[model samples]
Target: MNLRQTINSVQAHEKELALFNIDADERIDEELRSFFRTQNVRITTAQTASGCPEEIAVLAAGETVLAVVEVETLRELVDGAGAQSRRLGVTDTAYSEVLSHLKETTFTSCETADMLYASREIEDRARRNGTGTVHAGFQRCSTIVSQQAIYEDLSRTGVSVHAYGVPDVTPPELAGGQVHAVGGEIADLWFVVYDGGSEESQKSALLAEEDSAGRFYGFWTYDSAIVDSVCQYLTETYLGGNGQFPQFRA
Candidate 1:
């Protein structure tokens, strides 16, 4: 079916979705065909469907596309009865004359091909690494403490310390198979990221902060004694290193 016809037929399905891509030029706004025509208005406008604002007047603009999306949700009417499904429209609005504009509505052109390639590269690497305990450095805390001591005694003397999570399960691309530090912070997987409310769920807060790495960056605080204890233990352990070959017993 033609795209326009398909767009008209979209309705949320309980177990599936209907999607269609429309060229940017086919949109309500001036499309590719009117690129040259758009220049006369650019002096007073900041919108660019082609992502090529004033560059040669989109001399060779690529085809931009937006996805028409629809979603379905189900709710249980009773304890054992089958749930009822509700159809949701993507472009629908409470006012019959209005339309919705979501980030999903943004047009993506050939510019995204590089991003797509990078994602595929990351996927290919995970497949090669397989599922196994990747001991990045096999540092048994004792080793890290020693390194910390050496760094302190020679490089830094009185600065408070922050520990780095080593052997990060999945480090950034530039890490080169060697993860020296853990990420900024770890989430409490056992606890709800937030206290749930009538308007929102705890998971909603977490999901809202979820980043490209699939991690939720939650804020937290800690007791000073707990911090001191950790510092003292590491300092003592490192300072009391056994008199062994190639060791710093200072």
Candidate 2:
């Protein structure tokens, strides 16, 4: 199969092999459902930050791994190439919109950074609570340029990183443009298309799917064993039982 096909296949079957969640409680209404039915793609919400409860457990595990890394390096990795904690997107227009939204929104300026920090805290806490091995994979633009930077960053924090792609996935034109802006690098990047339809089609189809299913959601669940293995590697390779990292509480 071609790249696009490969991406689609990967996305369609992501949950078949991985452990993830679909929030069945957050359903859409009928009006939205009817509107979405004519669309070609579906849009569903997934927890991407520390605030979501479903993600809290796994995020905590990620934090435990991060605590062992050097703080200055972690900060540098986050403040990549002098870019601040601003909204990022695949195109100029979208980027602009993200910036505008960030400025106008009430979110904290250090939201992303804090989220990263908290992931470590959460992970540490979870481990203490005896939560069995947790596996978490982060998804972002996975190309060569970003990959090296991301790899270096995650490596310092003791995360075992890998590159994966969704099959048959033609990243949105805007996303493609963004990747280009960063230099056609796909190294540390992993791609997961949230909505598998045209921009116009996605909004409606997503609404319809949510309404029919009585919930709004997204896909892909990774293997818990994979998460455990990666974490174990990091703990053994870098953490080495130093216990210098701060302990986390639920």
Candidate 3:
């Protein structure tokens, strides 16, 4: 399946996050709620007369409660320790927490900033592992100009990198990185898929479509099977028939 269809396959499942005893300022409260909504997770709040020491957040799929974490921890995620942390780095920790409990789940609408944070997280993981096949789609090659360095660094680590986009700009040199210039449905997608080179535990992917000017609707997944499928489709569709690169390995 294509990227959009792959996302739709998992988007069928629904999940929710429930907050209990969340006594926080309206601004903070709304921010917390907005954070989960970006991931396509619904939020429900309830307060108890006997106030607890900390606010609790629970993730559930239908009647099954999947994960439980402190609401304050989530607040810390969005607000960060200071100005620098608030930028985007701290949110990686928060995304880890959310991903730990929710895998193969769809995130409804992710802003460019949100997608940027997540894409970096997945790329960082592949860099640290130093082994894996990374596929990044920029929609337009001009977009790849800004990320040229990032992919170059990733390729240096022995992670095979493939950059895809419309042939709108000259392809930048990316060391071990391979640039795929083409046109079709891929022009509307923004994605990053890493096939955790020899390890299933390290597999991860971020797939989204630029539905509007700056907003993308999609999901980030750590599921190896799902990740493999995405990588397979990209490899076959873009690299197939052409002996440019070998097939993607899961």
Candidate 4:
């Protein structure tokens, strides 16, 4: 399937987040709702029930509670130390913490900065593991240039790196990385997929497409099967019959 089709497949499994035991403060409640609105996560309020914890937010796939977080923590996520700001890392809230709670959840109309944060997280995993294959699509060659340094560093770690984009400008010469200057449908997509090398638990991917200028729609997932599909598609479509990317030595 094409990149867009791959994304649509994941989007079909919709999920919802329900807030519980939150203090009756309209401003706080409204802020929480507004924050989730950007991520396309459905937000609701429910009375603290037997199974659900007080002052917690429950993320559910229908009846199954997939994840939960404290309402106060959720607030800290949306609003950092600065009372009026939506900056991340507020009160010790980490970026990985956000990923843990929001993995496999769809986000609509996200900014480029948001995508960059998610991409870096996956890149960092591959860097630390010092193995695996990384597949990234930057939409344009210039965009790939913007991330050249990180990809170069990843290549130095012996991680195979494949970068894709339309040749809108000259591509960077990444020493141990392969640059696929292709066009057509791939030009509209931005993605990062890591195979987790020999460790299946570390598999993760971030896939998104620009819905409009400066606005992105997509999701980040840690599911191994989902990650496999994305990496497989890129391999078959770009790497050809060999079905293998060139390995780089550390």
Candidate 5:
């Protein structure tokens, strides 16, 4: 199969697998359902059989329910990101809080966690918890998140990283042209589109710090069209990749 087809197949399998694997409770908590609904997260009730491995909730951003959120009830919440704390799978982020709030939801254990996985790649506590063997495929969290530096955050669930550290690679003075936020929202706006060679675009030799999502940050745009155009340039030119796209002498 082609790259696009393979990606789609993997995505489809993941969605089906997530739903099929969940062991839902008899009834969902009304308050918990209401809270998620308010945040635009679609929640549904599941019918789990008696011998199911673990319980989980289908969480969807759009029509696709690509994730499962296991509910957890807590008498007290403990939180930390240190080595010891992370190994225990302890987290108090927004994702975990929603799970904690639900009274009827049963938490998803590591053994049962497949779809909506915590970003922690290491399984230091696996020998004790007996969840599963430490999978080699986990992404080791990065320490420095500076521009061009990459890291996986426990708070986020997808390949996309929305969190970005301050920009140190690119200076503001080199910005080709500024894009300010519109609708009366105005401030210093800038962007750097990777042109395959460097973060600096040939059009505007200015360097915008490349963020975790592979986009240049540290700028705002008043005109949506300008930002869209810049991003489109990045996608069409860079996203295709160097190998897939054959280079030619101009």
Candidate 6:
């Protein structure tokens, strides 16, 4: 669904007593109002960022409230509000934990796409290499592959693979037949290949390329029998389809 619809869903899920506290500044409040209006939601209060102790207390009590804190206001609250403003200890402990959890659960459009791509790349490389290990240069990159795989494999009874983090300057040849690294890196690079055809004739492939630290790049492809074979391969390989990978820890 679209972003407005998504926000509406969140608002609908919220409890009736949940308050949406926004900044009192005209410009900031107007911006937030526009956002909530698009989702057919309303703000309960518009007060100075530092003037929402009651709202903060409610949120700290585990109420599902939405608060709009300006960047400057967030900084002020975290960095000591001085003698004139009362400090809301809720900001650091309760609010911070909730925000962190929300941040972890939420994914941006680009981030979701990147994660899907990374999962496919890792799975395809593992299959092409005929090995269980998928090499990544960075931990974030590896985590993306592992996390996706953990979910995908659990849903399907498929062979799982492991991820390895290698140095950027590591030789691609050492990574077996399929090297999976970020594009343009010295190691093997993975890319998505789309088949431009009708639904019945469409296909997708994961292409991998290996390059010396600076020279002699070579490429290969892992072709699938069907359009969704690539996605299925990823889901089964990492996350486990049909709950098969129950204990497969990332």
Instruction: Give me the candidate number with maximum lDDT.
Output: 3
Tens-place lDDT per residue, model 2, 16-69, is 001113244533222222222211122233454453334111111212321122
Residue 235 displacement (Å), model 3: 1.7
Q: Which regions of candidate 5 fall more than 4 Å away from where they truly are?
A: 1-28, 60-66, 73-250
- Best-to-worst ranking by TM-score: 4, 3, 6, 5, 2, 1
lDDT of 1 at 138: 18
Per residue, candidate 5 scores C-alpha lDDT tens digits across 150-188 of 222211222221211123222122121111112110111
- Write candidate 6's Cα lDDT for 112-158 as tens digits: 33334534543554344332223232222444344454424422333
* Model 3 local distance difference test score: 0.75
lDDT of 4 at 44: 77
lDDT of 4 by residue, 158-214 (tens): 899989888778767888998878876677788999999988988988888876565
**Candidate of highest TM-score:** 4
Q: Give the alpha-carbon lDDT of every model.
A: 0.22, 0.26, 0.75, 0.73, 0.26, 0.32
Q: Between prediction 1 and prediction 2, which has the larger lDDT?
A: 2
CA lDDT for candidate 5: 0.26
What clash pairs does model 5 have?
179-221, 180-221, 180-222, 181-222, 189-220, 190-219, 190-220
**What would the per-residue lDDT of candidate 3 be over residues 1-250, giving only the tens digit for each residue?**
8878987877766678778877555455567565555454677777777876358888887888887888777776776544444332223454566645553444667767768887998999899999979999998888888899999999999998999878777767667888877777768889999999877888988888876576778888877888989988877777773535442221
Could you tell me the TM-score of candidate 6? 0.25
Lowest summed lDDT window (length 10), candidate 3: 83-92
Q: RMSDs, each prediction?
A: 22.4, 21.4, 5.5, 5.9, 16.9, 16.5
Against the true structure, candidate 6 has what lDDT? 0.32
The TM-scores, one per candidate, come to 0.15, 0.20, 0.72, 0.74, 0.22, 0.25
lDDT of 2: 0.26
Candidate 4: Cα lDDT at 127: 92
